[model samples]
Target chain A: MSSSSSADSRRQFLRQFGLTAAATAVAGPTVALATSPSTMQYDDQKKLGFAIVGLGKFAQQQMMPAFKECKHARITALVSGSPDKARKLAREYGVEEKNIYSYDNFDSIKDNPAVDVVYIVLPPGLHAEYTIRAAKAGKHVLCEKPMANSVADCQKMIEACEKAGKKLMIAYRAQFEPFNLDAIARIKKGELGKLRQITADHGRSVKPTEEPAEAWRVQKKLAGGGSLMDIGIYSLNATRYLTGEEPVEVTAQEFSDKSDPRFKEVEDTIHFTLRFPSGVLASCTSSYSIQEVKRFRAFGDKAWLDLDPATDYYEHHMTIGDKDGKRQPKIKEGNQFAAELDHMAECVLQNKTPKTPGEEGLKDIRLVMAIYEAARTGKRVKV
Target chain B: MSSSSSADSRRQFLRQFGLTAAATAVAGPTVALATSPSTMQYDDQKKLGFAIVGLGKFAQQQMMPAFKECKHARITALVSGSPDKARKLAREYGVEEKNIYSYDNFDSIKDNPAVDVVYIVLPPGLHAEYTIRAAKAGKHVLCEKPMANSVADCQKMIEACEKAGKKLMIAYRAQFEPFNLDAIARIKKGELGKLRQITADHGRSVKPTEEPAEAWRVQKKLAGGGSLMDIGIYSLNATRYLTGEEPVEVTAQEFSDKSDPRFKEVEDTIHFTLRFPSGVLASCTSSYSIQEVKRFRAFGDKAWLDLDPATDYYEHHMTIGDKDGKRQPKIKEGNQFAAELDHMAECVLQNKTPKTPGEEGLKDIRLVMAIYEAARTGKRVKV
Candidate 1:
């Protein structure tokens, strides 16, 4: 086989057997070592360093705390518009003062060897710009979900990363959550029979806060569309990974309370249905006018699996059942963001494509755009 | 107030407090008595007797067993295409030999004093014919859901019953299911804040059985559409009642495995999005190619409510909580089918229109047709 095909085969073998670098490195004697990265084989325990952009509530509260749990990843750099907040967090996280950079000097990170990956936790509008810059800086990129505001921007981010020969991963933390990962593995194993339908919903009530970090979410230019780009991407991405298929057509409806000032520039809620190529269907809902709900239920011919609160950073639980009765699947709870960070670090260290690659991110953004278009036109949009 | 207005006020009051005859007759002075039906006020304990048309598996297995738990309803007669089966069931239920009639002599039920109502449990194509016949024979009608095969047929069933001065109810048992009832009450009380979105899904894997009752479901002329008419109606009706508003527009997608002989004449799956008058959106799915899953989740500004296995006969459960954590609501389980039967009986005895009146049934049928049209043409259909 050609060198590329040989590498692809090894990647497939590892993925199929549910072997991560941590597991394979420990089971070296029994497992084939040809696919194992040289660093892992030699017991090189170097952690891939991440430079988190935008020291917002999500970064400080979720991502920063998650880094403490990550085995193969650590925060080595911090980029923020707020110098005081960035400097303070850097000191607390044990990062050097020279590693902190503002948005204006973000490109200067090319000379910073410590920052091996640029993790963009910025607003949707800034994702493409920072991701491309990170790729150009010879660092891998781990951008947050929704990829970018538009399909063209997502494509640009993907192309820039590819051109620079740098890995690009989208931080779809749900994909790394225990329950969601378990569901995917079981579905692939045909535990639920042939997959037929997926119903996913993710939303939370968004109240206006005094914090500047929350302000950009309600802005159309910064957030892309509305709750859809902010929270609905969870449902959209979950359905794709669960079905393991691309949706061929989409029909959507947008909703917003005209009297509500918060919805003046964005939709409060949007519901959409996706029709996959294999005649499978997925119905999803995303909203900003509701309390938190993250649920994913996949139904197959023989059985069904449900994960209520599916996308939580921790405490994700699941039930595997059919028409007869429900059986609780033993779930191991962990920080999803941490798992995601570790996975990205492994991909970078091993010179392997990310499990959630830029292409996967691009597919979802394209679908998000199609969903918005369908809702606006009141017609089905092919993706 | 005028007599009609006074009657409306009384109906509204009883409905608001969820004072079914079974509850009010037992609660006595603790609950308001002014709204109590006069028939119940006079110490009347007479249970309305029903002549169930179409002695099929559903009627035999579910509705028949449910009658034992009903407070104000009983099976006084049985009408069937098979004389032997009807006579056998009538004998077991302690009905007189003369009370049993084959389809050929179904109109003879008019003369039978035991038959206060005709519950049509036939195939969709037969529902209209039998409902009209029973209405002409001066019996109140409680037809099973989907109302009929066509919108015109649903209208005909309504007019015939109206002309006969008998109550007409469509057996939307999910509305009477305890958990569903609790959700409606909570939403109406603003306990969950302003309702913003509803997501409902109902479906089950339908494999063709040797029984003739299962055969008609796959036949287009008999069952109308496929999954939408049979099971999708639950999601559609739940959305309507939950929002207390009609959907202004609907967009839907259809799916069917053509290789499966069962779907030769109908779609196996359908996903639809309903846009309500107040901008609330409901995304729904109905399928015949999956294991049992009936779930309804309502999201409001303050909180959310979920009913998993929402429309089941016995095992319905619920949880009411928001983003913080789940708070289990004390769900009172009851036989939904029995509750539905009692409601129809009470409506007849009290000279009141059923909550799921013929008009309500007609509205659902219209939307069902709209959904099918949208799915077929791949365009938004106005309801």
Candidate 2:
């Protein structure tokens, strides 16, 4: 695809998200790779420089590799507790030694003009702290999902970013993926007729049965809830976007077998139903003890569409069924993480609101808390 | 298929249902068409005779035609409020003039020994009335789904049948359909691992918007509770039989736009969530204003299975997914109504309990009432 066609596609894609003119203008201009003023020869000053905090597995595997495909974003610095591992990845990715910093001296990043954006990819308990600190340090923040451990923390982070006049975006990468964007476009166009219901699920077995629950994700204080805070948010967010409606009430149930070692500290599964104000209902489930299963199916009065592995990085695909017949529409595929990163970069440079700001993240957190309440009380709780 | 192979398959199928020895013996022995002692040459005394009440669209199109494939069942009588229509279908299906009766003279069926089973295919309000009259006539009863208009009526029908020393079965044909049976067999065999959740929906558009509400189904007094009574029962019953567990609580919501004439007296849509005692949860939806959408998906710890158009007569198909990959097993296809009719016939012939008895239908009726209460009050209702 040429740059002009890419720009057109991005325009069409961002339109479904209701992006503003400033965001659209950022997509039209091309930024040439410019070296930093300091000895960091690999740093591109024209592109938004991202300081990646927490060099964990997901950051190293998905986000680091995705920077190669981003047009307006580049990783300029790394902040990690392990200096040796951070130095090894910096050498492989061509980052200068001066740009690399350990957690002990993370506050010194404010002095580095090379880092324009701070991407926090730490555990749930640390998200609000780092986001507020980054905003105070005069840098845009791209925080990973679930915002924080509680709704109060999310609000604090949002207020901090607003006080600092810095852009704050949540890493809801599915909102930027091509397949989900196409689905939203079709629904908005009324291609599937009046929306009625949405059903989605995301599940995967993380490790072997014999594995111990030593990971931060299995710790309740660090991860917040269980699978709901991790993967269930995808289905919940998908329902909101597909129907363009917020749920009015929620009822839920949690399941965990004591015999399963992985669920010693957390729940293994959760099933919930969301009743929308328009009378549309969504059935959602999330599990950490099941084989890979990711799907989103939207039903309307005239037709239906299904997306199996709906939120995957590469294998996401869709099938639309109507009176004519079922057919798989050609959906453009690209790096899932790069689009969100570029969007955040554009939002910062243009001084515009991010598509998925702190408010959107807080909305999901409120629903999650309601779901937990419903499950605990066995009643339908209003959202 | 050879006759012996067919017999073997029938034996295997009936075994899953736990048929009595006499029923199995009847399957083993091939019986030639035997004439009745009277002048009705087409009537076979060896087969159970069914007196079909209410010659409506469903009985005329599906149930009557299915008798041709049933080796143990044959249509021997017709009872209708419209005598002309009764005479018409009776002639076409080879029923003697003396065997046909009007609803006014329905009690006279006791004089005809050829009428062994009374199949009631009327509106929900009339099911209990006809079932009780048929039971009093010393005939087994096979009633269409939603068993009756209320739980009290269902209980009364069961009591009347038990007093008459006759079997009473609900026409939950999906339980006997080959595809659904295969799916159930696999689930029982642990092919999908430990069951965790079930999601299902049944929705369809019936007629144009301008059509008048002339049918009895649109009246609350006759049809009970609209889509939930008409179609939602499929998904509800499926969750029960598939999991072999009854739901302990339910939460539900009903939707209908007043502008739509069809829903002026009834709900056009309903969504409900079921929580089983075993911690298994099922989310189900039904609608009367959507295009055909029938599906049932069961999720488990190690794998999952999906059945699109799960409750259809001929189009139902299933796909299983596991660690190895996804695969579609070739499920046997046959006349959907034949198995249920044959089972009822064998149950009467062998003096055995019907697989789907009146008590089973009453159990579902109790849950249906609970669901309505939950939807009305917006609170979880214990079953």
DockQ winner: 1
Residue A203 of model 1 has an lDDT of 87
lDDT of candidate 2 at residue B169, scale 0 to 100? 97
Docking class of 2: acceptable
Over all chains combined, what TM-score does candidate 1 have? 0.86
Sliding window of 10 residues with minimal summed lDDT for model 2 chain A = A24-33
lDDT of 2 at A91: 72
The two-chain DockQ for each candidate, comma-separated, is 0.62, 0.38
lDDT digits (tens) for residues A1-383 of candidate 1: 11113233322322322223223212211111122111211122378788998777788889888888888998888875455566577777877767777555667788889889999987787788788888988999999987988889998999999999999999888888878888999999999998999988888877755443455667676677789999889999888889888989887888888687778888889888888887778889999889888888999999989888788766776888786888988877878888899999999889999999988888888889899899899888888
Q: Model 1 misses residue A183 by how many Å?
A: 1.1
lDDT digits (tens) for residues B323-367 of candidate 1: 577788887787889889999988987898898998888898999
Candidate 1 C-alpha error for residue B131, in Å: 1.6
Chain B TM-scores per candidate, in order, are 0.86, 0.87
The alpha-carbon lDDT assigned to residue B383 of candidate 2 equals 86
Q: Candidate 2: deviation at residue B347, Å? A: 0.5
